[model samples]
Target: MNNSRLISLLGISTLRAAPRDVHLLYLSRFLRTAAFGSTGVILAVFLSGLGHSDVRVGLFMTLTLVGDVFLSLVLTNWADHFGRRRTTILGCSLMITSGLVFAIASNYWILLAAAVLGVISPSGNEIGPFRAVEEGMLACLSANYDMSDIFAWHIVAGTLGVSFGTFSTGWITAIFQKPVGWTEQESYRVIFIVYTIIGIIKLLVALKLSNASEVSRPTVERQQDAEQEEAQPMLQSEETSVAKGPGPTALMRAVRIFVPELTAPTRSILWKLCLLFAIDSFASGMVAFTLLSFYLHSRFQAPMSLLSSLLAIPFIFSAASSLLASPISKRLGLLPTMALTHLPSAILLGFLPLAPTIELACVLLILRAALSTMDQGPRAVFLSQVVRPEERTKVMGVVNTIKTLSQSAGPTVTGSMAQAGNFGAVFVIGGVLKAGYDLALVGLWLSRRALAEHDDIVLPNVNDNLAENEGESDGTSRV
Candidate 1:
């Protein structure tokens, strides 16, 4: 009975029942995050080794995120209409490009250009349109109730990948330097080389996704949209001959661009959610794991290997904590679970800088880790419940873009502070902002009322097949 309960709570059935495509998505995320994790550990150290100042390192992160913001906005907005698979492939390709360039080049301007033009993660967080697109796909790929379970395992895969990457990268960095007499930059480049290879593997994995992962659109409607596409430019071409105000064609096109992607009701709820998320993410950006690792290294003189081992603890604990998210959300509801668990974690973050010893800081971080990430699965489930299938991708894109835009400045702020010897304030301010954001979510936004509770918005159109994707099966649950 205990074993049965454990399997049920862990949602082992959900994993076993998931389709191959869903599994592919999970694998892609795991590989991507492993690359991200390794880079997170080494990026600051690499820049420092390159003789860049703290502020330059911070600016590098800021620009990386700013570039990410634009990239995410464009790709996510086009993903549903253009093709999810293509978007993912492009993203992976960009990751490969960024990793290769960073591995080969040491020039700051060149590295910054590569980062801005392609995909690289300095904060060790998801940094592209992949998350938004995948979340949208995941929402449609499974039952609404199973969403949280899928997300839980997804988080587990990601955290474990991070743990593996960070731990491995640390050892690799140390090993390469020990007897090989390799310089610090050479050691770090090895990780980026590995990152580039992971991107290739992920790209191959992404190519295997079945049509079941894409959003369903009607066949005739697709034909219509395609036909309209070929004629839109010509239609707009006639604007030169038209009488004032550009023309009807141009005006309608402009309106379409200006119109909100979501429905009025979804907008009403989601705008607030976006704002709260932006605030929370800004706080997160302030203490990105890379910066945190930098702080430890600079302040306590922690070695790279030891620093990575210490930093990886939270991801492991966070992964385990995510397993509890589904059940906890089921009991406490998503928002309540998110708010209640997060507040304490934020408080712990507030106290992190106060720790006089690394051991105490790790203890506080472990405790904070146990709670900080418990909300992810619930939040995914909540968004899936609240947003319609057609709008999910854009909604995620918009929200994530907003969050990234807000977060982009945080590392710079933290960087400036570290330059001034006020680095410790980053954690304190981040914690307080995060705590207040959690409260505002419940208090000002009334998120505790549970948007999913007011009306149980469910997805029921997984079979809305496309003509081009004619033979693709839904890849329904297994035995």
Candidate 2:
């Protein structure tokens, strides 16, 4: 009984209740994000070391994201039809291939082509459909579990992965450059080689997933049924034009497939979420770790060891802070929790550039990290609770799609500013913009609070829900 309580406190009982495949998915994400952590730390400076200008580096980041947006859509749209496990393997394969090319290729065009054609993370976060597919698989494989715990631990795993990846790359590169006397390019290439090895391991993990991870016939049938049901009203409507009366033309059918079938009210809220998240993402992109690391390298001439170690500090905060998301949201409600925690982070980000020393800057960054990701688990849980189960994935996908689109422009703009010798302004503007977004989100929540609804649920009965969930998934083995 004591062990049972301890396990529950730790999280989706840290996968105690999860199926073997769910555990595999978490492992896959950890390895993949760690690889992202490795490359994201060096992506910008590596390009600059290759003699590319800041503008070129920024443009490269932007174009890579632009390509990724399309790649994500195509692969995710076909993920189920193509097979989830197979799709996962394909992502890993791309990771390996991309790493190998980045490790060896020097020509800017060749590197760009490799980045666009395969999996390369510009922001050191996920840039592909791997997240969505894996989340879906997790949902299916662990149908009875409380995803809040699962996702909380999920964020922890990814952040920890980043922490490891960044620390490893920083020290490894520093060792190669200072001790072994390697060139900057050589050290960076070694990091990519390490990334490739991780990718290979991730592929092996993906292969271990059972057939249960694939989309079932019932799920496919339900989707098709939902699609047809959604179109029925449109087809029957007098306003919707068809090739003929009542019947939807092939073109109309094709176009409608891209639309989500949600209630009008949910659609309105989701749109609001899209705008909020898109703005936040844009602000975030402007100060991406890749760019920030580059800034430190250029401005302070900080060693790779310092950059990696200092940057890794925040991921530690982020990982620890992620554990607090579920509990905080349960108390403050999702919107309040998101807005309150994020506002401080944004304020800290704004002040980051004002720091006269690297030590001070790291202090602000560490503080920001403590609050920045506390929203991730809650935001995901918000999506799950705000809409029907069927709508959850689609809504999350839509928000991510818009957020990525908005973020794609940020690096280029920031690069341009850096090239123009206005690097500090980037953070100021991003911080201001992010703060405004948080205020606007809070306003939205307050406006909805006049009447009792989901927002008010936290005030009255959130603890009850938390207790219920705890009782339901105790994770204790029975005798």
Candidate 3:
């Protein structure tokens, strides 16, 4: 074919092959993340403005993260069973409710309750069950496409939303507070109002997603195939004749559905992944975006508007790096890509506290942001590949829960340190811990790869033995 025709065919193929649900999920992520980014940048400052102490602000952030952990664990465990589309809609609804409560309520107790029960973002990232469930659904729908590429675009969408929201919140507050004669608190509340409106739009988009977005459970046909395979015994003739027992009680069955049943190999890999992710998340919590915003204000007496603008720089670079993830992972492989890209960012974080000036610190942070998130897409793809298809929801849920739980400790610690006049220590310690996590992750990945290779070799030998036994049984029947 001519070059023109060939190029046209490739373009059409790329666009047409991606499922509609994938696009809708991208939009949902963008809208939700935009809301998160806006609130995340100002949450700590907003609380402080309301006469809350730094410790209280930190505690609020911690509780918000902890709440997400619990809710995500419950919702994501049953996401497949409950329907991905429906669960996502529900999550969005919670987000809208959280925004409304934050916007209208001045009672500290009521605000805390809203934060705990509803979807709220303190990390300038995904805050509830949406990410895990959406990722699981994307993996299902994008089975026929380049999964890494799709995930990269998904990250890009989220990061862009965050960038825009972070940048706009500063201006939004400035616009409302100055010319419009709104109170500082009221200015911040305006962002939450926009957050609620975005949530409504996201919910509408989520509703448009088709049922094909749901996780594919094993059908009766698949069950029958499994039964036939089990019945074809090589040497265990008596085993096939055993009558099937009665089904488990309904209560027991319900419990079983919530618990993930993975093979030994898959479980081991999952555990290793969870441990590494927890370590990284804990480090991340120490300098979560909200706390970071607070730190800048307290340490440098930086204006809220400047802090917001500076924070947006890193997100822009992070979004750009996300676009490179797919091509880089294609060449370097998933594990190496994640380790190489993430280690540099962690090391850069170590330099953040040492910067001589605010400008230098911003540059360091922007650089860190560029490299830090390059692992996200690869990590998501890796997890999807490592587990059985049926267990993706459970695995993602468990992993995210562990990560969130680990992260919940960070804000509290950092907040206390800030109150104690030890803000530098928080950055130094978090950087050290994150660097350690990067090294450990590489080691774990190598070990898992070695184990997988060993299993690959051992499986064939066992299969050979089973085949020989079957031949012997055939000969005996002929005799």
For 1-479, candidate 2 gives per-residue lDDT tens digits of 59876566657475776788877887888899999999999999999889999899999998888777766665666667678888888988988999999999999999999898888999988787688777666545544666667778778888999889999998899889989999888989999999999999999999999987775665555666866776676554555554355456565656534554555546767787888898998998898889988887777888888889999999999999998886677668777888999999998898877888888888899999999998887676666555433444455556666777788899999999999999989999999999999999898788767544643433222222222212232211110
Query: Over all chains combined, what TM-score does candidate 2 have?
Result: 0.88
Candidate order, TM-score descending: 1, 2, 3
Off by over 4 Å in 1: 219-241, 244-260, 444-479
Cα TM-score per model: 0.88, 0.88, 0.86
Cα lDDT of model 1 by residue, 348-467, tens digit: 998988999887888898899999988887777666656555666777888888899899999999999999999999999999999998898667435333443565532212122211
For model 1, state the Cα shift of residue 31 in Å: 0.5
RMSD of 2: 5.5
Mind giving the per-residue lDDT tens digits that candidate 3 earns over 260-332?
4444556766777788889899999999988887777777887778888988989999998887877777777
lDDT scores in order: 0.81, 0.78, 0.79
Off by over 4 Å in 3: 1-16, 217-261, 452-479
User: What global local distance difference test value does model 2 have?
Assistant: 0.78
